[model samples]
Target: MSLLGDDSTESVAETVQETREVVQEEAPPKTGSTSFKLARLLFGGVLAFMAVDNFRNLEETVGYAESKGAPMAETTVPAITGSLLFGGLGIALWKLPRLAAGAVATFFVGITPVMHDFWTIDDEEQKQQQMIHFLKNLALLGGALAFLRVGEDD
Candidate 1:
């Protein structure tokens, strides 16, 4: 009765194929390469775990930050660590990836030098440790910057 092809097996199969093509066209591109995804997962998980560790040792963390001349160490440390917590989760889960990257980038930018001022340290052993921490933060920052390119509106 219809002008279009009948609801025969072939017609149904053709319709399915057309629908699949449309879906393929409309679907979002892949988020990241497999290697990058795995890296992101580990990076985010480590940041989150670090935040938890910081919180678990809040007093010691606050004291350390205070020793580094961090203003409002008690409040600032917790607030900054929160960015790590949520940002890490978002980065790992691919939720709000841009904002999450921003949060992570903020941490590395804001705290890396202040907390691990290797150049300012006189003690070789302490300076070496701090330098390692600083470089680690820089590497993590590089990863966060890469994640900023991820196609995500949230």
Candidate 2:
């Protein structure tokens, strides 16, 4: 009976140790350059495209900004477009990513509330549309934060 008890305790300890080892072995490594590049493209591509689209339809974008009660729609629109273009390219190219992330994150923070103010909308369809855009921008903000933290030893 003593022999059986001793063997069982040892077996349990061994099993625990093996489990730990397996978990450690299976842990994912840090993101490699290839994976990081792909992530960068995914995160930055949308902003770049948006910037280009805004440039192409500058007048329409300015009008939308004006409808949202943005001051100086003409000047603000061009400035926003420039920031988006530069920030998106910087992020995608891994050039000053922290700053680029901050820019992109800032863009989302400033635009989401103003552009997608569901609380101020009367129509149900518009409210729903604004809510969706608001949520989507928040998710993008989270992604930008992650991108900012990437490469930090933390």
Best by lDDT: 1
Q: What's the distance in Å from true for residue 37, model 1?
A: 3.1
TM-score of candidate 2 to 2 decimals:
0.76
Evaluate all candidate structures by whole-model CA lDDT and list the values in order.
Answer: 0.88, 0.83
Candidate 1 on 54-103: residue-level lDDT in tens?
Answer: 99999999999999999999999999999999889888888888999889
**Tens digits of per-residue lDDT for model 2, 1-154:** 5666988989999999999999888734355558878988977888888899999999999999899998898998888788887778877887887788878888888888988899999999999999999999899889888877762421
Any residue pairs clashing in model 1, and if so which?
Answer: 96-154
- Output the worst ten-in-a-row residue range by lDDT, candidate 2: 145-154
Tell me how many residue pairs clash in candidate 1: 1
Prediction 1 TM-score vs. true? 0.77
Least accurate 10 contiguous residues by lDDT in model 1 = 145-154
TM-score each candidate: 0.77, 0.76
